[model samples]
Structure formats: structure tokens, C-alpha cells
Target: MKKNILYLSLAVIIGLLGGYLLFSINADSTNEDLTDNHNHLETTENQMWTCSMHPQIMQPEPGDCPICGMDLIPAETSAEGLAFNEIKMTENAMALANIQTTIVGSVEASDEDGIISLSGKIAENEENNAVQASYFDGRIEKLNVNYEGQKVNKGQLLATIYAPSLVAAQQELITAASLKESQPALYKAVRNKLKNWKLSDKQIDAIEASGSVRDNFPVYATVSGTVTEVIAKEGDYVKQGQPILSVSNLNSVWAEFDAYEKQISQFNKGQKIKVTTNAYPNKEFDAVISFIDPVLNNNTRTVTIRTTLNNKENLFKPGMFVTGKIEGAIHTTENSLSIPASAVLWTGERSLVYIKTNPNEAVFEMREVTLGVRNGDNFTITSGLKNGDEIVTRGTFTVDAAAQLQGKKSMMNKSGGKTMTGHEGHLGIQESNTENKPNSDLFMEMNLPVAFQIAFQAALEPYFKMVDAFVASDANQVLALAKTTLEKMKAIEESHLNKMENSHLSKSIEILDAISSNSDLKNQRDQLVVLNENIVALAMNIKTPSETLYVQKCPMANSNKGAIWLSTEKEIKNPYYGDDMLTCGSVIEEIN
Candidate 1:
């Protein structure tokens, strides 16, 4: 019995030991599984990301950005405190947003200048012009100047006239001369009277020596000039003081121009003007403004600007059509930043621009800029901006739309102003593909193909978002999203009635871009709202213009009834209409 108990105890101990061994193995496997799972999580947390332009993308996990791609940079978020409206992105996001920037140096303060371009016709200077008239009633016996453009010297004989009174006067002089020695005083008085009648001393001497009555006398030129107008032909009777010819001095002529009321501010007495005439296309005449009309033409709404030009060669003639530019002082208000007028987006009240922020980021920020003056092609920024602030010299509209889609500020906000929400990620909205955009049919009732309509609809998707954002005054968001959508639509393959497809969409995209800049959107809000309404209405009304196709009206584009459609034969410069402009609405047309 003792032996049996010992064997049983040993067996129990072995069984328990075996169970313990099995349990240890299971624990090790469980630990290994847990460790593997933790390793996997760590790997996921350590994924890296980066931007296309900036390859310095690094991240602890798999996400959009490291530095500027998706606003994922911890430094960016920490640099500017996080806010609800603030959106941080990764480098990829930035690339997607097409956020572009450039480095800028400090700009020196300079005066603002404006240049006004105008067209005018060359005119004769009245002050330098003169007329030749008859001293007494007579008939022209001969003509010294047979045609126009004949030069005559001062006091030179121009024509001869015969009159009964003149004959009687000559007879009296002759009779007095016959008794010269008997009545010397009377003869001298008669001679003096002849002199008073404009008879030259030499002529009087010749008549006294001849001792005879002259039936006709020669008339002389009052001034030297070219005969511009001939009032009397040979043998034509003329009354006393009647004009025979109008003469204008060719040595010096008038460079006269008309300045409109709006351009009056540009007209100054002594402003240097470079004048050109059709007669001499290759030659240029220099002159300074000598006279400015105080009164405007009641019918033409223009003020006359006059200057004297040296036409000694007689190259310039009266009534010659001419064009000139009066380079004058640039008008400006005090304390302002002047940039190329092309840089400003005139939305109405405020001006907006896409300011270059960083070249590395290829990013620009939409800024509202207060304007003071417009000189020539430059504009003065009164407020909301500073010198050395780099702006998009070109393609600003495209950049602004990208900013809006990423929840950034844009110029087209319905609200008046915006506060910086901090650095957000780039959303690299699709670039505007204007290549295939066709002209709009806003005023036409023509039908388009189904495929074309579909393409158009696709293009409009982003526009709707853009308009919505604009109406809500979500400047940044609207710009960013709208830009992307428009860009994408522009890129899509389109159906076209003509070579261009969805051209009106491109115009709408441009409008959205202007809004995105946020410079002058407050003033332009009313106009923009009207544009938005029209776009929406048009989109809603998009249908087949004819039985076989679909169509929609782009109010900002297309021709209307009784309006000559010259687009087919010539280039159309109409600013109010086109494919890209379709979404701009009827405001352009209405105001125009």
C-alpha cells in the first residue's frame, strides 16, 4: 500500500509540473502577440509625409503634411495658436492649394502717379491765324495767291482792286500835285491822306512823279502766312473790310486737343505733350499746353487744350486728325503705397491683392488694401498693406481661389473685413484650365451637345461652392474651394460647339479669384451678389436650347438682339461678356 501511494504522489507531481509548463508556454505566446500589436501601432505612428515642392516632409504618422503640405507641422500650429477657423495643413495640402510665395525686400516710399491717355484732333491756333480783307469796296482785278498753301510776306501785294471812290481820290491827288508849287501845303495834306489809306510812301512817290490819276490800286497782305480760305475769286466784288482770304502762319501752328471732363484733372497749363499726326506718322511734335478752356463743350463734354507747334516746314495742315499723350503729374493722396494698377482688384469699395509671403512656401495671402490714388497704371495703397509686401503681379485671381478652398481669407467676402486665422495647410486647388473654354452663349438661344452640357455642369460644381462661400462671407473658404473646383472643371475634357469649351466657366473662376483676394470685396459685394444670383439662375435654367442639345445663359457673356455680333469675323473686346465671364452675371452689362 505504501508503494502504491508513493507512485501516485509522483504521478500527481509530474502532471502538475506538466500543466505548469504548458501554462508558461501559453503566457509567452500571449506576450509575443501583444508586443507585435504594439510594434504595429508604433510603425503606423512613425509614418512620414511631405510636400512636392518642398521635399523636407517629415511626420510621426501617415498624414498629409510635415511643414507646409497639410498644415501638419507642429511648429506651424504652435507658432500661431489654434483657433476654430484656423486650419493647419501638411506640405501636400499646401501643394494642392497651389500656395505660392516669393521673398521681397523693403520697398522705398515713393510718390503715386497717374497717366491719362486721350485722343484728339489737331487744330489751327487762332491766336497765330489772320485774315486778309478789302480796305474799300471793289472788284478783284488780279489774284496774287491763286491757291491755298501759298506763302506771302508781310505788306506784299496780294491783289489789285478797282473802285470809283478810289479813282476820284486819285484824281484829287493828281489835281493837287499839278499845283504843287502854288498850294504846297494842300498837296502835302492830300499825300498824307493817301498814306492814311494804306498807300505806301514808294507808291505815293511814283504816283506824284507820274502826275496822273490811277484807276486801280494794289492791295497788300496784312500778315505773312498760307492762305487757308479763299472767300473771293478773281473779279468778284467785295465790300469794304470784307475778308478775301484767311491766312494762318505756317512757321508756328496750334497743337490743339480736347480734354474730357473726367480728364480735366490731367490737363494743366504747361504740361508737356508729345503730339503725333497722320500726315507725319514717323515724326513727333513737341509742345507745351499754352491754353486750357475753362468751359467745357456743352455738346461734346470736352475742354479744349491748346499748344503751339513749329510747323516751319509746313508739314502740318489744318483739321488733321492727331493723337497725343499729355504726360503730367501723378495724382495721389498722402500716405499711401503705390503699385502697378494691374496688381489691384477693384471690387468696389476696397481693393484686394494676393501678397507674396514666402518663396519657399510658394504661398500668397489675400489682403485687403486701402487705396489712395490711381496714377497711370499704378495704384496707391492707403492702408491694409505695407511696402515690400510682394504681390502677385500676374495670376493673382488663380492664387486667391486656392486660398479660399483651404478655409483662408479671400477678397470676395460678403463681409467687410477679415482677421488672420493663422497659417493653414495648402489645398493646391487645381489650376484654372482656360485652354478649352469656349465662348459663352448667354444671349443666344442656341443648343449645345449633351456632352458639352455635361462638361459644363461638371465645371460649375465648384462655382456653386464658391458662390455659396461668397454669399456667406466666408472669404477664405470660398476662395479656396471655388478655385479648386473651377480649376478641376477647367481641366476636364469638354464638349464644345466651337473650339473653346466652358470658356464662361473660366470667367466665373476669375470672378471667384477676385473675391478670394479680399482687397476690395466690401465695395464689390453688391455687384458680386448680383453676379452670384445670375449664375445660380442660369445654372438652374440650363436646358436644351434646341431639341438636340442643352444650353445655359452666361449673362456676363454672349451677344444680345440688335447688338451686332462681330465675334465671328473679328476679335471681341467686350469686357462684359465671354465664357469665363459668364458667371460674373448681368451686373457688368447693367452697369456698362
Candidate 2:
């Protein structure tokens, strides 16, 4: 009975030990799970937050972006393995931006010639220009052509003149006609004298047949043409051989193009040129270089190139802008590689292009390219691009924008940094760095007459008034202000300005004149954008004594291309957006 009790005690002790070991294992597992949960919570708290619109902004805590006022989101933890100069974009974004690429290839031999592009205007052919002059000292009794651009036909009656001399001559002719048997030479002299006055032989014969003197003589058109100028008016006394009117024959016109010194070498007399005009975009007019001016215009540093066009249809009008392309075997070679100009982006002195590195994926890398001569719509790639390389032809600006947003190498930023925030990071918000500003040198060397300074500053007042009108969204007021500004600009003595300064002022006035003609606020604003550039250039060259000028920039203007205007005050008043965004600009520079 003692041996049976010992066996039961051993069994009970072994079962108790097994139960304790199982409980310890379960407690240790519960502690380990709790430790893992604490670690995951710590990691979630440490994730970096950043703004989506401004990817350059990063913070440890969630907040709004200081630059664009956008809420911050958690940054992606995975690193995007991209090169410093490379930018990756989704296919959908690329399509939405209208990005297009072209594969560079060898140009055909027939199309390898370099073309020279020139800007010019249609003008009257000097050879076809005619002047109508008075044949005798007389008073114009009646004028038929009232205004410029009136068309007159050959042998058409143009005017009536009352000439006492012609009446006396006619009386002498009658007397001579009676004495023709006795004084035939006198009679012939009288007739020849009337002929000298441009009287038709038929009219002279009719006068002699009636044996009566006519009070007034009729003037006829010698050539058929459009009257370009009316030199004389009715009741105005004119001397013999005095110009009465000027006419230009529209049967032929001259397409006069300006060629710079560098481009003049590519042109030769009789070279064939293809001309295009905005008025008739599809039609190409073929012409030959008739003449090239031997003298260069010092101010423009260009020479006029003339090409005659048969304008029998009168399709081309004077003052119409034209683009001429001269294709010749000038600077073209079989080994030359040319790309569309759209593929190139210009940032100061650097010319950059986006190179497609991957065919399957939408990957683009910024490349610095050396440019040669531009031929029509294409630019010759001197280096950095190969014949078989793929390049971004269209939407290059869009690509650069994306690169800028992603902190990749871009046109403005060669070595990309984290995206910038705040007012300094906004596009077109330029801070004045007086020490490094390009125009700083110009300011140091500038010297202007006191009169010029006062006049130029006064001119800005009208422009500012116009800006106020625009801010009010008053189209009529803008129009009226534009006219007043134009008159003020025109009244300025341009002779006081040097050649360069005068040229800038003239361009400004031309733009303002364009603004005056358009009552549409948008059109006026568009013109103002260009006018602002001219005024800024003018202000930079001339001294503004005792006056402070503010150079304001609007990034949202000109279809988002951005523009700058000169203002007298530090306050922002945007003319481009008018009342909708009257204060959508920042002061970029201050000129004193």
C-alpha cells in the first residue's frame, strides 16, 4: 500500500511542472506582440510630410505649404531612383501637356539646304510709282480724288484748273488760226504751246474747230493707279510742274525684307525666295531677289532686300507683314543634324533640350546643346545630339515646368535643389540683387538731359493712368487713356534721345498706338504687355531723376507666359488681369 501512494505522488508532481511551462511561454509571446505594436506606432509618427504642389517643401509635422498655401501630405518613403538631370512623368500627364517627341534622322539631300528666314513688309514698286503734276501755273477749280487710296484710270479726268495764261494762249491760238495762211508757224507754235500743257490733240482740235476759248482746262490721269497722296486741294494755286498727286500702280509690288549683316552673306541677286504672309497662310509666293541695298542702315544694322511680285490680283497690300525664306546651298551639309526650334529652350545664354533616354518609358533628361545657324523652322545642332537620337520637339516648356516642380535639372536651375517655397519661389517673382543685376552696369553709365528725364517721367504718368483704368475694367476708359498716353508720348522730343533710346521710344509709341485702336480690353491688355517691355527698356537706359520706379511682374499674365510693367508706386496693380486679379503681381525691381 505504501508503494502505490509513492507512484501517484510522482504523477501529480510531473503534471504541475508541465502546466507552469505552458503558462510562461504564453506570457512571453504576449509581451513580444506588444513591443512590435509600439515600434510600428513610432514609425508612423516619424514619416516626413510635404506639399504635393511644391514638392521641395518638407517638414516633420503636417501643415500647410508656405509657398502655395496647400495642405501637406506624407512623403513617399520609397526613393525614386532617377538621375539628377532626369525627370519621370506619367503617360497621361504627358498627353495632357501635349508633349511630343521626334526621332532625329538624316535629312534628305534635296532638303538639306539651309534656309534664311527674314521679316519684311510689302511696299509699292518704285518703278511703278507715278506723280501727277500741274502743267501750268493755275488755280485748282475742282478736285475729283478726295482722299488717299482712290483709284484712278488712265486718261480719266482728274481735276479742272483755271489758268489765265492758258486762256490768253487760247485767244492767241484763235488769232493765229485765222492767220494760218499768213502766219502758219505762229499757229503751229500756239498749238505746240497748248500741247505742252497736256491738252490732248483731240481737245485742241475741238477748241480750234469751235473758234471759241474755254475758261477751264481739264487735267487727265497719265497712269492708272491708286492715289497714295493728295498734294494739292481745290482752290489751291499750283505752279507749273508742281506735284498734284502721287499714285502707285498695284499691278506689281515689292516684298522688301530686312537682312542683318550676318544673313546678308547668304543672299545673292536673283536667288529664289519663298514668301508667306499671315493674311494668306497657305499660299506661297515665289520671288527672286531683285536688289540688295549696298548701304546698311546704321540704326537697324540691316540692309533692305527687294523682291518683285506680280500683284496683278492685288492680293498683297502695302504694310502687310511677310516672312521670307531663302533656300540655297549656303550653310547646309549632308552630315549636319538639325532639329525643330521648338525642341530648344533658351534660358539666358544656355540653350537646352530634353533628350528622350528611354523608348518604352516616358523618361526625359535635360541636355545642353550647342546651336549653329537657324534654318527656317529648324536649328542646326552643332554638338550634343546625334542623328539617331530622340528629342522632345514640342511642349518643351511643359517638360521644364515638370522638371522644376520635381527638383530636376531645368532651364533656370542647372543644379536642381529642393523645390522652393514662399514668395521667393513663385514664378516671375524676381528679387532685386542690385549687385548682380544685369542692368546695374547700365545704370552706372547712364547720363540723361534734365529735360529728357522730366519728359520721360511725365510720360509714365499717362501710362499709370491707363493702368488704373484697366484695373477698373473700363475698356472705354482704357481706350481714352491710351490715346492720351499716345499723344503725350508723341509730344516728347525724340531728337534729344540717342539712336538706341529713340528707337525704344518709337517702338513704345507704336505699341501704344496699337492699343489706342483696339477697344477690347483683352486686346488692349495684350498690347500693353508689349508696351510695358518697351517702357522698361527705355527706363533702364534713361535716368529717372527724383523719381522711384517699380518694375512689377505678373506670372499669370499673357496666357501664363508672364510679363512685366513699370509702376510708380510699390502697390501691385495688374493690368493684364484687370479687376479679376488686380493685385496678382509683385514688385521685381525698384529703379531710382
Candidate number achieving the greatest lDDT relative to the actual structure: 2
The C-alpha RMSD of each candidate to the native structure, in angstroms, is: 16.5, 12.8
For residues 1-592, what per-residue lDDT tens digits would candidate 2 score against the true structure? 8888999898888889888899889888988888888877776675556656444444556777544557877766512455667776655446555679999875555554666787788999889999999999899999998689999999988999999899898888888989999989988999999999988889888888998989889899999999999999999999999999999998999999877566667888999999999899999999899999999965345689999999999899987779998886356667778898778775324678999887877788999998776666777777888888899987676677667655678765778866433223232211111121222212323355677767877888888899888877666678778888899889888666664456457657866776666544555675566577667766775554467888888876754556778887899988787656788978877887
Off by over 4 Å in 2: 1-121, 147-149, 171-191, 205-213, 231-237, 257-265, 273-287, 295-304, 313-331, 345-370, 383-392, 396-592
> Runs in model 1 with CA error above 4 Å?
1-114, 278-284, 332-592
Per-residue error at 134 for model 2, in Å? 2.3
Cα TM-score per model: 0.40, 0.55
Task: Give each model's whole-structure lDDT.
Answer: 0.55, 0.74
Model 2 lDDT at residue 59: 53
The CA root-mean-square deviation of candidate 1, after full C-alpha superposition on the true structure, stands at 16.5
Give the Cα error of residue 136 in candidate 1, in Å. 2.2
Tens digits of per-residue lDDT for model 1, 121-239: 56676777898988888889998887887778898889998877777777788889889999999989988887777888898888878877787889899888778888888989998
Residue pairs of candidate 2 with colliding backbone atoms: 56-419, 67-422
